[model samples]
Target: MPSTLEQLTSNRVKLTVEIPFDELKPSLDKAYKDIAAQVNVPGFRKGKVPAPVIDQRFGRGAVLQEAINDALPSAYSSAVNANEIVPLGQPEIEVTKLEDNHKDVLVEFTAEVDVRPDFELPDLAAIEAEVPVIGVPDEDVDERIETLRQRFATNTEVDRPAQDGDVVVIDLEGSRDGEPLEDATAQAITYKLGSGGMLKGLDEAVTGLSAGDSKTFSSELLGGAHAGETADIKVTVTKVSEQELPEVDDEFAQLVSEFDTVDEMRADIRKALESMARLDQAADARDKVLEAVIGKIDIELPQALVDSELEARRNQVSSQLAQAGLTVEQYLKESEEEAEDEDAFWTEIEKRSLDALKAQVVLDKMADEEKIGVEQSDLSELIVRKAQQDGTTPEQEAQHMMEHNHLAEWMEEIRRGKALAQMVAKATVKDAAGEVLQLDRIQPDGSITDAPAADEQAEAVEADASTDDVVEAPETVEAPAAVEEEAPAEESAEKKPAARKPAAKKAATKKPAAKKATTKKPAAKKPVADK
Candidate 1:
C-alpha cells in the first residue's frame, strides 16, 4: 500500500491511497468465504462454495462493496500514519476507484481529514492577567457563619405573614384566559420564598400571606401545559414559618462544624474564602493566558471537522430534549428562544463548534510541546469521582468505560487541563487592585494544590473553562443500550445524520439561556454524551 497527501489547506489534507491487488486480495477472499456460508449451493456444503459461484450469484459490485467496507478503515489508518498526520477526528473516506474484476488493477481511495495545524507558542512569562484581590470582609464571615447556623436551624411555626427567607406550604392552580390547564395544579408543595425555580412572581405573590389566606395573582407558568403563557395563579398558604437558627456559641459551633468555638468557625470560614478567591484568580489567569496564546497564532479551519463538531453539539441537545419528552420547537420555546429562529440557532452552534475546535488544536499542541500526560493517580481519582457520581463502584465504572471505549476522552480532558495549568503558572498575575497576586493555590496542571476538601475539584472544573465540554465519565457509563442507540455524534461531511425519534416536544416555549456552554466537543467521533 502506498499513499500521498495533498495539502488542501493549512489544517486540511486530502490523502490518496493505492492498495496493490495483493493487499486487496485478503478482504476479497474473506468476503467470498463469508458470503459462501450465507448462501446455499446445490452441490456444495455451507461455507464450502467457491468464489466463482458466489460471484456469479451476486454481481462484482456487491462483492466489491463488502471488500471495500472491510478495507477502507485500515487503508485510511495506514495513510494517516504514513503521512505523520495528527487528525482532529476521523476522516471522510471515499472509494474513488474499485478494481472489481480486474485482477491486476489497484484499489484506489481518497480520504479528506482535518489535521492539527502547527503554531508557535509565545513566552508565557510575558502574559499578564488581572484578578480580583483576595480579601474576606467581616460581613462575609458573619453571613457564612449565619448560614452554617441556619443549616442546623429548626422549623418554627410563625404566626406572622410569610416574608422573604420564609417557608410557605401552599396549594396552587394555574389557568390561562379562564381555561384550566391540565397538569397545572399542585397540593401541599413546600416552596421557599425567593427560591424562584418554580415560576416568576412567586416570591412576591407568596410574600405577606398568612396561613389560611388564599389569593390569586398573575405569573407565567414555568413548565407543563401553558408553560410560557401568563396565567392566573391561585395560591393558598396552609402554613407560614421561619427557621429558628441556633445561637452563635461554642456548643452551636461544635454541633455545626468541626470547630469547637464560634470564633474558630469564623476563622476557618474566612480562611476558606481567601483560599477560594485565590483559586478563582488562578483560574482567571489560565483563561486569559490561553486566549492570549490562541490570539497570537493563525489557523485555517477544516470545514469538514467544523461541520462535524457543530452537528455533534446540536444532536447532543436534541437527544437530551428527546429523553425529557420534547421537540426542538418546544425546547426553543421553553428556553425562551423562540425568537432565535432555526437558521440563527444553527449558525450559533456552528460558531461555537468552530471556536471549540480551534481551542482544542491549540491546547493539544501545547500539551505535546510540554510533554504533558494524564497520570495514573489522576485518572484513578477521576474514575473514583465519576463512579461516586454514577452511584457505582470504581471498578464497575472503569470496566464500563473500557467496554464502551471512553478512557481516551477522559484522558484527553486531563491532558489538556495539565497543559493549560502549565501555561497559567508561567503568566504574571495581578489582582484588580494592582497587587501582585500570589497563585500559590494553583499547580502547574491548573489544579488547586491546597484547596479545601469540600467541592475542591468542582471549583477547579469551574475555573478551567477550556474543559467545560469534556464528556463526563458518568454520562459515558449510562446503560449500554442508550450508548449503542445514541444518535451518532456529528457525522463526517459525507454521512447524513439519522432522524431523531418523532416524539412531540411538549415543553413550554421559552428563551434559551445566555452563554450556554458551546464548549469544544472535538474529541472521539462518538455521539457526545452531554452533561
Candidate 2:
C-alpha cells in the first residue's frame, strides 16, 4: 500500500492511499472462505468448495465486493499509521478511484482533528499571581453554630400571633382575576413565617397573624399555570408555632455533636471555620494564578476543537431539556427565549468553554516542560475515594465509570489539576494583603506551609528534606508523561506518605482524594470466567 498526506490546515490533514493487489490478497482469501461456507456446490462437501468454483458460480464481482468490505478498515488504519496522523474522531472516507481491471484501488479520506499545538510554554516561575487570604470572622463561626442549633431545635405550639421565624400550618388558595387556579390550592401546608415558600407574597401575608386570621395578597406566579402573571393569594393562620432552641450549654453540645462540652464544640467550630477560610483563599488564589498565566501567554486554539466543543454543548443542553419534560422548541417558547437567540446562549458557553480549553492547553504545556506525572497508585487511590463518595463499592463504581467513559474523563481532569498545581508551585504568588506566599500553604492539605520561602536558607533545607524523602522511598515507579507532570504537584501538596492512606489516616483526613482506582483484575476476571 502507498499513501500520501495532504495538509489541509495546521491541525488537519487528508490521506490518500492506493492498495495494490498483493496487499489485498488476504482479505480476498478470507472473503472467499466465508462465502464458500454459506453457499452450496454440487457433488462437493459443505466446507470443501474451491474458491475458483465459488467465484465462477457467484460471479467474481460479488467476491470482490466482499473482499473490499473486509479490507477497508485495515487499509484505513494502515494509511493513518503511514502518515502518522492522530485522528480525533471518525474520518470522512470516499472511494476516489476504482477499476475493474484489478490494477489498484485508490481511496481518499480527510480527517478534521485537534492536534497538539507546537509552542514553548512561558516560564511559570516568572508568572506573578495574588492568592486571596480571607480571614474567617468569629461571627461566621458563631452564625454556623447557631444554624446547627436551630436545625436540632423543636417547634412548640404558640397561642400568640405568628412572627418571623415561627412555623405556621395553614390552608391556602390562589386566583388570577378572581378565578381560583387549579395548581394554587393547598391544605394543611406547613410554612415558616419568614421563609419564601408557597408564592412571592404568601409568607408576608401570613406574618403577624393570629390563629384563624385570614389575609389575601397579590403575587406574580413564579411557576406553573399562571407563571409570570399576577394573581391573588389567600392564606389563613391555622396554627402558629415557634422553634424552642436548647440552651447553649454542655448538655446542648453533647446532644447536637460528639463534643462533651460547649467549649469543645466552640473550638471545633472555630477550627472548621478557619479551614474553610483557608480553602476559599486557596481557590481564589488558584483562579488568579491561572488568569495571570493565561493573560501573559498568547496561544491560538484550533477552530475545529472549538466548533466540536460547541456542538457537544448544544447536544448536552438539548438532552437536559428533554429530561425536563420539554423539547428544545417547547423550552424556548415557555422561557420566552427565541430559538434564533442561540447566539446569546452559545456565546456564553463558548466563552466558558474557551477559558476552560485555554486553561487546559496552558497547563498541559507547562506540565510537559516541568515533567509532571501521577503514579498508578495515586490514580487508584483517587478512584477508590470517588467510589466511597458515590456510596458504592470500588469495583462497582469502577465498572460504572468505565462503562460511562467517566473514568477516563475524570483522570484527565485530575491530570490537568496536577499540572496547574505544579505551575502554582513555581509561580510567584502573593496574598491579597501583598505578602509573598508559598504555594503549599494555600494547597488544600496545609502542606503548603512547609514549602520553602524564596530565602536561600529555606531553599537549601527544603532541597535536603526532599532528597531524604526520595531516598527513603526508593521504589521508582514511572508514571505517564502527562500524569508525571501533575503527580508531583499533588504528591508535594499532600503530606501523607501512602497513596491510599491507612485506615487511621483516613479518619484524620476527611478531604476527598483526587482520583479513583480502577482494578484491571475485576474487569479482566470476567473474560476468564466467560471462557
Candidate 3:
C-alpha cells in the first residue's frame, strides 16, 4: 500500500491511498459473497451467482463499488495506524479509482477526516498547583456541633409573628387568576422561614402575619404541573414556633455522638472538617494541575470535535435535566443568560468542552509517556466506591452496569482516572505555607485511595456555565450537568456535568455512532464511504 497525506485546516487530514488490484481481491470476493446472499438471479441458488455472470449482469463498476465500500474502514484504520495518526471523530472516504476492466491496475481512494493534532507534553514536574492549607475554623466546628444540637431540639408554639429561622404552620392555596390549581394546595404546612425552599415570594407572604391572619400574594409556582406558572397564592398562618435547641453540654454530646463530652465532639468536628478540607484541597490541586498543564501546551482542535462535543453536551444536558424534573426551556429561562439567548449557553459549552478535550488529550499523552497504567484493584476500588454510593454491592453494580452496556465506558473512565491520578502524584502541589503536598497515587502501592468527596450540587448550565463558580471538574463521573462524559466526556463538568475537579472526571468518552448506508445493491451505488 502507498499513501500520501495532505494537511487540511480545522485539524483535518486528507489521505490518498493507492492499492494494487491484487490487494483488492479479498474485498472483491467478500462483496460478491454478500451480494449473492442478498439478491437472487434466475436458476442459480442464493449464494451460487458466479462472479463472471454477476459482473455481466450488474456491471463490474457495481462490484468495484461494493468492494470499495467493504474495504474502506479496514484500509483507513490500517493507514492511520501505519502513519501514527490520532483521529478525533470519524472519516469521510471517496473512491477515486475503480479499474473495473483492468484487474491488473490499481485502486485509489481519499479519506478526509478530523484528527487530533499532535502537541508536545510539558514536564509534569514543572507544573505547580497551589492549594490553601485550610484549617477547620473554630466557628465552623461550633456550627457543625450546633447542627446536631438542632436535630435534638424541640419545637414550641409561639404567639408572635414569624421571623427568619422560625417554623410556621400555614394553610396555602394557589390559583391562576382565580382558578384553583390541583396539587398546588397544602394544609397546615410547616415551613421554616429563610429556607427559600418554597415558591417565589412565599417568605414575604407570611413573615409578619400572626396566627389567623390571611394574606394573598402573586407568586410563581416552583414545581408540580404548574411549575413556572404564576399563580395567586393565599395563605393563613396557623401557628408560629421556634426550635428550643438542646443546651450544648456533655449529656447532649453523649446523645448525639459516641463521645461523651462537648469538648470531645468539638474536637471530633474539627478533625472531620479538616479531613473534608483536605479532600477539597486535593480536588482543587487536580484541577489546577490539569489547567496548568493545558495552559503550557497549545493544541489546534478540530471543528468536528467541538461540534460533536457541543451536540453531545446539548443532548446530555437535556437528558439530565429531564431526569431531575426540569425541561430545557424551563432551565434556560431560569438561567437568565447574559446575552439572554441560547447562543450564549452553547458558546460556553463549546469553550468548556474544548478546554476539557485539550486537558484530557494532554493528560493521555503524558500517561502514555510516563507508562502510567490502571490496575484491576484500581478499577475494583472505584467500582466499590461507586457501588457503595448507589446502595449496592460492587459485583452486582458492575455486573448490572456491564449488562446495560456501560462496561467500556466504565473501563475508560477508570483508565483516565488512573492517568489523572498519576499526573496529580507527579505534579508539584504546594500548600498555603508553600510546603509540598503529596497526594496518594492511583494504585501506586496497589491500593486505591478514596477520591475527593465530590460536591453533589447540579449547576444549571444554561444559567451558570459562564459564572465564575462553575469549576473545572464534572459532577458525578458521568452526567449531563458536566460535559458529555462519553465522547471523551470532557471532565469539564460542573463538566463535570464529574465534580468539575478534573474534566478528566468524566472520562467515559463515547464513540459517535457511525451511519450505515442502506443501499440494497450498494455495489451499483457510488463508492463513497462515510463515517
Candidate-wise lDDT, in order = 0.63, 0.57, 0.62
- Residue 243, candidate 2: alpha-carbon lDDT: 72
All predictions: root-mean-square deviation over Cα?
12.1, 13.5, 9.6
Q: Estimate candidate 1's alpha-carbon lDDT, on a 0 to 1 scale.
A: 0.63
TM-score of 1: 0.70
Q: Write the per-residue lDDT of candidate 3 for residues 264-340, one digit (tens) a residue.
A: 87776666666556656666776777788778877877766667666776676556555544554455554433334
TM-score of every model versus the real structure? 0.70, 0.67, 0.70
lDDT of 3: 0.62
Rank candidates, lDDT, best first.
Answer: 1, 3, 2
